[model samples]
Target chain A: MDDTTARHTEKMRRIKAARDEMMKTKTEEKGLIIVNTGKGKGKSSAGFGMIMRCIAHQMPCAVVQFIKGARATGEATFLRERFVDECRLFVTGEGFTWETQDRDRDIAAAQNGWEIAKAQILDPDIQFVLLDEINIALRNDYLDIDEVVDFLLTQKPHMTHVCLTGRNAKPELIEAADLVTEMTLLKHPFRDGVKAQKGVEF
Target chain B: MDDTTARHTEKMRRIKAARDEMMKTKTEEKGLIIVNTGKGKGKSSAGFGMIMRCIAHQMPCAVVQFIKGARATGEATFLRERFVDECRLFVTGEGFTWETQDRDRDIAAAQNGWEIAKAQILDPDIQFVLLDEINIALRNDYLDIDEVVDFLLTQKPHMTHVCLTGRNAKPELIEAADLVTEMTLLKHPFRDGVKAQKGVEF
Candidate 1:
């Protein structure tokens, strides 16, 4: 063999050995409680991507929007219209906090949303549940973190994966999550006076 | 008006005024250079989500994978099988750095992938272009950053939205980007001895 080919083969051998060692310890299979939080875009978008992944796997899923209101997002319209059997969508908020300044009304919306989320979590056929913007509701104290955590711990099916997406995720929720990602804002067009566009932001 | 009704109306009036002011400043429409990079997961997954968004809008799109090998990823499989007319998939890498173990081969792969990506960027029919893991290739010196940036600036269609996803994005790229998100790793299941699952990871 040539020198370059021999060196490459040797390098791959070392990598394979290390990978095998890492793979040996990764044998557990269970549902994941994933949290996507921080001050950046794409948290809910990522959650929606996971729902699409579930659909690709032919697994049923549901989405509950907590603070985005009844306005038709591109995701909501597409998922509801195209994948009816695979997705059950509920847009449960009047709007954002500033848009709906009444705390009592926001609280009632959160409570109503939680009930639907709870039902989806208990449904055996639904393998994936996306609680879109639930973190913001939790951050605003619209929903009790303890109640949410308790239900997530005790009632979720063993193989049912749940993802919560929004900024300011509660520490208690983070502590209970199996995976957490914080989308850090490096730059945003809105800061430079660009508006959110259809299909891109919605 | 009753006390509660009067308060609610006032709150909505304030909200409407703020929204109107914000809307007045957001009138420009152009293509976006979006970057997703960091040490956390979901960079490429989020890019795939954008492809889905484009599909939902009935806009044509293309994805060129730079570091991920020509394996049958769930996103690739589903997109190719279902959205044949809307998506153009190109898997141009043999594998990751360790898997390939040859810098020259890696560079060649990146170059070839960039050619495909360039064509897609200039295609007016394709509204969205996803350069999945191209940032890692650039970080590894598999491709020239200046050439990529210049091409992105000069040749991209007026309305084509391009997304680049990977870790260690170049500073120059971030500066040129319209939107940038850094996915921070808070907790990963791999660190906790959980294996990557089919639907979630692939």
Candidate 2:
């Protein structure tokens, strides 16, 4: 080997050793409370992608969409058509809060979706559950924050991984979560008057 | 209808009218440059999810992994097994930079990956291209950011969407991108002594 290659090999050896040492301390494993939130795109998309990974692993998944109304997305269609046995999907929202304009109706829809979500979360048979846009309900006071957090922290199944996605995730939820990622918007073409594309956006 | 229902209906009608007016101004359709960056999880996961979206839309996709090495991921396995006809994945990364530890080898691998990426990006038949972990390559100076940005802006087809995902994305790429999202880490279980789970973390 050349001088550069020899130097690199030696450097890599040191890093690998250090990494291995740190990795040894990580031994705990349990179901995770994951949240995807913020004022950016791909929060829901990322959640759906993990569902695909779960499918690859032959894990059962249930998806509960709380705030987006009766709109079909590409991933939803694919999941419905191909992975019926693996995925259970529920779309339970009247519409966006601005479009719906009825607080009681919004609360009713959120509660209904939460009931289904809770069932899925408590089920040991299902390995993954995605609560898409349930945060909007919590943020709007349509769903009780304490009840949700209590169930997630204390009552949920031991092996059932759950993902909550939406903007404005509550501080309590973030604190309870094992993983929380906020998708921050840097720039969006919609601000430039570009229409949302079918596969890319919806 | 009751008084509350009537009022809610009227409010929704007015909001719908306003939304219809704004949506009329958005008529442009073109390929998008999307960037997912920052110090959080799911940037790569979101990109992979869009690839599933593309598959559902019956669009062709190409994915070039820039820094993940030969590691076998669940999504990559699913894509290869199920959507082989619709998706083409090239795992070109030698490994992570620190793991590789050779600047010249890193540059060579990145250049090789870019050549493959450029072919996939320039191809009109491929509707979506995902350059996974490419921002790492760009940030490390393994590839020319200007040349990459110029190609994406000027040479890409009109209807092909490209997603570049990793941390520390350059300013030029973000400015040139149609959509940019930074995955900010609110909390991570790994830091709290949880090992990376197989299907979830991989």
Candidate 3:
């Protein structure tokens, strides 16, 4: 082999050993509070993917999309049509806060959505609950962060996994999260005058 | 309404108008080269999510996982059992390049895997392709980036959407991509002694 390749092979050997050693010590499994936030895209998509992962194992899952996103997103349609046996979806809010045009109106809409989310989250039958875009509600103070976190951490079943997706997640929520991934937008097509397409942006 | 609420609503109204105007100018639809990369957790999940989005529209899809991650992950099993009519999965590689312990062996496996991927990507029947963890192969020189990009951009059909997921994506690949998201790992359960769960990690 070439010189660089031989060196890389040697380096990979060390990394492989380290990873193997680290992996052996981990044997504990618990429900996770996974948060996907930041200004980048893919948060909701990743959350939906996690739901898909659960449905793969025949595990019961639910999705509660807070704020907007109720106008027939691609994921919502797909889930309703294909995985009805394993999944339930709730796309909440009349519109975004801006569209609602009033603070009280926005909160009232979100509170209504939260009632359904609370019931599904606390339901013992559900194993994975994707709190889709609920972060936006929390960020805008439409939902109380402490109350939401308390239910997720102390009230929810030990085996229940929750993934919260949206931008501008609260700092307290991040601190309490077991997994937090920020989807950073490196480049977007809209800047180049391209529009969101079906089966892609939806 | 309160003074603060009135001010915020006014600002939102203006912003909403701008958005409505910008959205109308976009009517183009083309195949996209989407790249998800970074030291984050949701890269693959988001890619899988996009695949799910397509499935929502009943678009044909295929997933080709590179490097490792072929030990019966949840998504792989789920897609195979449930979406046989909509999707196909091809998992390649004996192990990671490190596990292979030989550079040539790694390349051979990657090349073998690429053949399957190229076939699926070029296939007119498929609308979306997820090249799961392929950035690893390109980063390690297991496959040539230029050739891959050329095929994805030129040879592949216009309606075909491809998502390349992994860390350390090449500059050329990123430059050619339509959407690029970096999954920044802010918090991981492994750091706090928690193990990867079945549905969450897989």
Residue pairs of candidate 2 with colliding backbone atoms = none
Q: Please provide TM-scores, in order, for all candidate models, with all chains considered together.
A: 0.93, 0.94, 0.93
Query: Highest lDDT among the candidates is held by which one?
Result: 2
Model 1, which residues run further than 4 Å from truth? A1-12, B1-16
DockQ for every model, please: 0.54, 0.63, 0.66
- Tens digits of per-residue lDDT, candidate 1, A1-202, equal 7897678778877987899799899998888999999997778778877777777778889999998875667788778777888889999998887776677888899999999999999998888899999998899788999999999998899888999999999999999999999999999888677778665687
| Candidate 3 runs further than 4 Å off | A1-13, B1-8
By descending TM-score, how would the candidates be arranged?
A: 2, 3, 1
From the highest lDDT down, the ranking of the candidates is 2, 3, 1
TM-score of chain A of 3: 0.91
Error of 3 at A108 (Å): 1.7
Tens-digit lDDT string for candidate 3 (B23-135): 88776778888999999988988988988888888889999988765377888887888888899988786666767778887888889878999999899999999999899
Give the Cα error of residue A81 in candidate 2, in Å.
0.6
TM-score, prediction 2: 0.94
- Can you write out model 2's per-residue Cα lDDT over A135-189, one digit (the tens) per residue? 9999988999999999999998887799999999999999999999999999998
